[model samples]
Target chain A: MEAIKDKKNLQVVINAGWCKSCGICIDLCPKGALGRDNRDKAVWQYPDKCIRCGLCELRCPDLAITLQEAEEEE
Target chain B: MPVKRYLRQRFFPQLWCAGCGHGQIMASLIRAIEELGLQKNNVVVVSGIGCSSRMPGYLDFHTLHTLHGRALAFATGVKMGRPELNVIVPMGDGDASAIGGNHLIHAARRNINITAIVMNNNIYGMTGGQSSPTTPVAAKSTTAPLGNIDPAFDLVELAKGAGASFVARSTTYHSKEMQNMFVKAINHKGFSFVEVLTQCPTYYGRKNEGVSPTEMMKKFATTTTSIGSPKKKENPELIERGVFVDQERTEYASSYCEMINQMRKQK
Candidate 1:
């Protein structure tokens, strides 16, 4: 199972297995929300800075990255 | 962008190599479709055999994974049968230029309303890195160990000369540019063609000594000037990437449909 973090309705999931750490998304992120961890996998380095622009989600070559609004917790 | 709505999550992660540019191209395509708000039911994605051909399977749309190098022919039939569907073909360099070269030109000449996105990765990735028609003269491939002597085919120029109404070029390094080109090509009515430079990091980058995949991709940005740039004149080796040709022309399906209607009326 993949780790899905709910950062205030921002559901972000990083499938580390498929990630090749190309740094394309990391370089293109307008908000500087993503960075490589010790394992060389893409992680949400600045979750608070996430503007939900979808640039990383749309540009990820591996599809290892996913970003979506959290479901309403009503 | 609700990309998950259009992508098949069952096939969650694609099979492309980590640094492979195909996935980026695929993402741009999906974004373009979403931006245009084209429904999956009405948009038909067609592809020929190659690593790139696998795109349609992951995309949630009316797709046809056809024979090797025969995607244009298959797309032609689809447009003729159902002229309303937006047919988009994602072909590889070998798929578009080698075996399917003839069909490519004829489709352009007929001015079919299919937006053909040829992902020019230079080498045949699926076939274990053989030299393709678009491979540079000095590039080393499995088949060309001594460095290829053949001249590369300029796909953009080929499409323009073949009478395609819309022609453009962009590398996978430029994701936004690629998506924008797709938007314009889809908006264009007749034989729209875009040659996207996709890097096959596994196969295309192996033999080149001291050249990292990142460096190679950056070369696309530095080497190419847009169509109207005066810098294009300064550097002949620079690939001029932009919408080179766009003009009003009658689309194949509409014209054919009109002819069929005329015949029926006479009868």
Candidate 2:
């Protein structure tokens, strides 16, 4: 997670405002690609590891974390 | 973002409590429909009064927000009237088992082709945390001053025994399994029932177990086992998850149609 200074392709968008920080997505992430940040918001700790399985996307009750194509080109 | 296509975006910020699992059930239902490539217009979500019943208000579909604990009856009418449409009813524990208990039994007995998702949070969350039919013995609730003394209904067993053609149980923590079950329930031909366990952190958890949402979810993850797992024999406390009953039977609506046709021919 510390190595994820610059996130790349396939970003996980966490609508932190509605999130309960329940960690269902974190536990369901097949690649262990997500973790909660200091703000208790779900963040793609290692986006590179994500396989776009969408387990987190389909299962989140809050609709908090949605898988999206990386928004930024960087 | 894609799932937004199935939601009524104008209804953003649902009224459910922050940690309520209704949102997860909604997401899973949407994903299941998406996976099945179902047309939104062809799907009808019928719900009764309760926190989970509010799902139809947010989802973009032909919906009926009906009386408390009467969703199955209304859904039965809708399905019988238009057999082509997919009718899905979302009910809370009290809504399904307590007030509408007779309807639940009759619906299963008739084997009407409809899907019923019982969101069993075990407490009447919207009504100030009174113990519901699914509330386990010894659980504390507003109505259960000291502790709940009455035994809870084993919903899966009840559905199976009552003649549901398809029955399954899964929890909010196990999203993948739940989504698969929802899809299966929808696809099944006869009356399909899926009981989804959810965490009522605002009510049940706080008052009964005093655990946070994450803690409650973890408890579900650890306490549950697959229906066929050998661990079930050793740990009787483990709630078994997965499909319990699946059988092919002539659906009531179709049979009624055929009966009418036969009578017309005889005349």
Candidate 3:
């Protein structure tokens, strides 16, 4: 189990291929971290604002989104 | 500059229980609000009677510490009246699923825009160790001297079935996870319910195992499992304890707002 230490590094990744563009993740994100991109995929715009609440991942209808502790290199 | 931070609850302590999980739950709520950067003035904490329901007295934000079993009813009014503000209801097991069960079910069915955090300690610690609606069967409580004959109500499943848009469950010992779930519940646009399986060690514990609050928390840590992903098959009882449900349904508040907008446009 990977523990999340610094919440700022937390990032939400949406697999565009699997995404149905249902926008459930967008609506469920408490920090307003997600928005629709040009391709209609849920994009992480305000990544810093994310508290890694995991609501997006949990509420994703297609399970297309994943929350990961962003690599330190990033 | 905007206020650096505002105390969501008033500084004074209202809950009297020693090592009660209600205070921790309240603190998690306040931290979640701060993490979301929600203005304290725009957040309202509504509660009902019970040792846990006294949470509103400590919050600095707009609060309504109402009569027993009516927190949800009043919260509905608050959300309907001030749709802009964040409405959060912090309640005890008996206050939420027992006497207040009707309001709770309807609120979920209506998909009202309110976040209800149910602090389920099994027994009603407030009025002594009475068996609450969520008290597990065979659990020893003051009211059930021999043992509880009634089966416990799985609040998460009930809320999900009653039409809650989002439902999650966590424990007081898992503070970080509880905070995360709470943040999600608050941010959700529709009716969101989170069942916090807490410990009433002083009352429930003394009756059951004569253990301290810390020991009871250890039991919670051991007995419960995360919701979506079962930790392991070894403890079937502990499995299914984390974020059980998280999906979007038609939001009652936003849908109503849209309907009003369309009606005005038609006129």
Candidate 4:
């Protein structure tokens, strides 16, 4: 179970170092895939809910979020 | 290539205040360059002194951080010196319209092959929230303690009046639209001017009733409409955002070369 969860985490990566906790991504997200962590940074709280729509990635002003391509696993 | 490849990773956590729209503009620009498959070496990003001017430093492309309001001037020189290279100038509202207003008009009049992206944040973010030429009437700023009485310059009209071949406008809320506009402007052969209505949340927002960046972006989405939308007919006051002018013209660099070639033939 832990291995599967770790593998799924690679789908949407967020760089906390670059993130400024602006909340643009969370507010603009269509799927509500992102939520604020304890530190007020964005995190993929519900990875299953994400459709990989890339809106969060596109709308992130900080360039902290990157939606990995699904084909990369092949 | 990925958009990350075009960025200088060392500059992460940019100097802009949280939710400042300039970062979104930069992101759109990088995505546009990537979509166009432009060579990094062939591109030059130039900027004048302001919050928006800091963009060139973050990008990995050939960049020039020039004097205040003189980005277009320096970009003109770069374009003329190497006609094949793509030159992009990102400027702040004050940097473009107030101090560099003359250069802006002249650059457009010359029909030079350069892309100018004016990140219009209404106030001078770098200078402690002073009113700029594009600040809306009745908007309060540090300089305008009561309310700004002066009418703002319509940048789209101004660019068209100055003879820019490509003129467009988009707000930060419409990031996708902005990216597409950037692609089109960069592909244009003559002078291309794109005005992006960004937000200076820290200074401009706090001065005017303490509006946050999210609220500012929401206002942009509600107050602006696309060109030729029926809503615009119903409400003329709604600011129209889209490509205003796109036409082929004899580019300045090409015309100069042709003149030189004709003179050489006569000699």
Maximum-DockQ candidate: 4
For candidate 3, lDDT tens digit of each residue in B237-265? 76366666677778677777899999999
Candidate 1 lDDT for residue B181 = 96
lDDT for B163 (candidate 2): 94
The digit string of per-residue lDDT tens for model 1 on B87-133 reads 99999999999989999999999999999999998999998999999
Better model by lDDT: candidate 2 vs candidate 3? 2
DockQ of 4: 0.53
Per-candidate RMSD vs. true structure? 4.4, 3.5, 14.4, 3.5
- Chain A TM-score by candidate, in order: 0.77, 0.75, 0.80, 0.77
* TM-score of the A chain in model 3: 0.80
TM-score of chain B of each: 0.97, 0.98, 0.92, 0.98
CAPRI-wise, candidate 3 is incorrect
Best by TM-score: 4
Against the true two-chain complex, what DockQ does each candidate achieve?
A: 0.40, 0.46, 0.02, 0.53
List, residue by residue over A1-74, the lDDT tens digit for candidate 4. Answer: 78655445457889899999988888878888889999999998988887666777777778888877445544
Q: Compare candidates 2 and 3 on TM-score and give the better one.
A: 2
Determine the iRMS, in angstroms, of model 1. Answer: 2.4
- How do all the candidates rank in terms of lDDT, highest first? 4, 2, 1, 3
By lDDT, who's the top model here? 4
User: What docking grade applies to model 4?
Assistant: medium
Q: Which ten residues in a row have the lowest lDDT in candidate 4 chain B?
A: B209-218
